[model samples]
Target: MLVSNKLLVDNDCPMCKAYGACFTRFNLVDNNTISPYQKTNEAFVNDIDLDRAKNEIALHDTQTHQTLYGLDALIKITTHKSQLFKAIAEFMYPFLFRLYKLISFNRKVIYPSANTAVGRDCTPDFNLKYRLVYIILVALFTGVVLHEYSVSIYSFFGWESSWFLEIVVCVGQIIWQYVAVKAFRKKNNEALEYLGNMSTVSLIGGLLLSPVLIIQSFVVLPVLVLVGYFFVVVSLMLLEHIRRCKLKKFPTLLSASWVLYRMGVLVFILTIFI
Candidate 1:
């Protein structure tokens, strides 16, 4: 619901401005109520309550008789297109309302504003240089893996038969990847963290199955292979989650390079046994 006032308004609210920009780009202006209201019978708009509007922006859903104010209004405004925003609104709106109430209750202590800017500085400094270095290294490793894969595919002698050695190599690779991911996450690199967590779990599973693959050979190998394949699938799911999270950038090419190295090590072990 939108209430329009026929008063010249200063574009002050950052959240409202950002949402308005998004709405403009989306061409979703029909439902919106902009200020300096013209005398028209638009279903979305009603006469503005100056006192209520002065406190915060108000939105009323006529169908539901649901009214939203302040942050709720902002969230409701964003809820039309973005599912992520809707989820956030549903989960966080109550919490925000409570916080606002608490702050309003303790205005002096919480916000000692002497008619000046009274907000926490929440600027993001994305240290892209360090991230670039990390990306480059990962890319180099990926290149090595692709090269190795091409070489191995062309040469039948490159195939590995020793499942134990393959598992061991996989475990080692996973551990290294995990360490890299932890480091990245420490710097708030969520994309690396997701990949690292997935790889760590997969490697741990592979490590557990390594000894079993060695001892039981024919009996355990098939079962472990199936289990290992399941881990791979889960890892892929985690990767998809990471993608959806939109952690600034995509995972580096070197993210799966360890797998190629493990493949090479497995091939060498198989050759020795043959």
Candidate 2:
């Protein structure tokens, strides 16, 4: 349900202008009657407390007069997507709405609007240094796995399988990766750091597992490993670009793309084992 800015003209302010620009850019304005009260002919201007409007944006349900503010307003907007966003809004709305209200109220006293920066300002050196440790660890694990695979080829075929050792190495790698990520998060490394860590982990894992080519004899395994490695490298390069470009805030598009790439890696790994 797209709401039009024209419907709420009586209360138009700078906030409204910003919201209008965002809606227009997203092509979400489907109707000329944008205000929640416009179609219903309700006197929202008179009914709603002006004091509340000073601190919060209001969106009233036409049928119920139910007021939504902050994150509630965001969830309502996301509902129109009716796909991924909709599902996320549905699942996250209840908790997020309360959190938004709590933060919004506290922000009025603790952090004024004038002090808040529009976007994040994180340095490339800071991000790279933060992630370098994780990258080195992943590289080390990759080297070890590759070495193991190379040695396994010459060990009497089927006489003594190294499958148990492979499983142990995989589990150990996973544990180390998890610990590295946990530490990174605790340190509040920027999105670039997160992306770098993800890419390094995926690439290292894929390269190490490439020796699967010798034992599996499946044409798909090598292709999967190569594709995974390519994505990891590309993702890391894009993250580096994000820092250099000083693009819009942290959590850049590259970070999201890395997540999808990691998901693909997970699926490939599952397919290989199962």
Q: Give the candidate number with the greatest TM-score.
A: 2
Q: What 10-residue stretch in candidate 1 is worst by lDDT?
A: 106-115
lDDT of each: 0.43, 0.46
Q: What shift in Å separates residue 62 of candidate 1 from its native position after superposition?
A: 9.2
Give the per-residue lDDT digits (tens) of candidate 2, residues 1-274. 5643322321223344456456656766545534522222445555554345344455555546566655656666656767888788778878776655543332222111222222221111242432444444454565455445434342322323344544444444444444544543555444334434343445544564566644555443344454465456546644543452243233344444445544655575456545
**Model 2 spans > 4 angstroms off:** 4-17, 30-43, 61-67, 106-274
Candidates in order: C-alpha RMSD to true structure: 16.5, 13.7
Candidate of highest lDDT: 2
Please, what is the TM-score per model?
0.26, 0.30
* Steric clashes per prediction: 0, 1
Q: Write model 1 residue lDDT over 1-274, tens digit each, in one string.
A: 2233122111343433445556545654433444321222245345344344434555555555455665666665557677887997788868876554433222221112222223322222233343333333333443333333223232444544333443445455545665655554565455443443343334334344345434544443344454465456546644643442343243454345444554566586556756
* Candidate 1, position 218, lDDT: 48
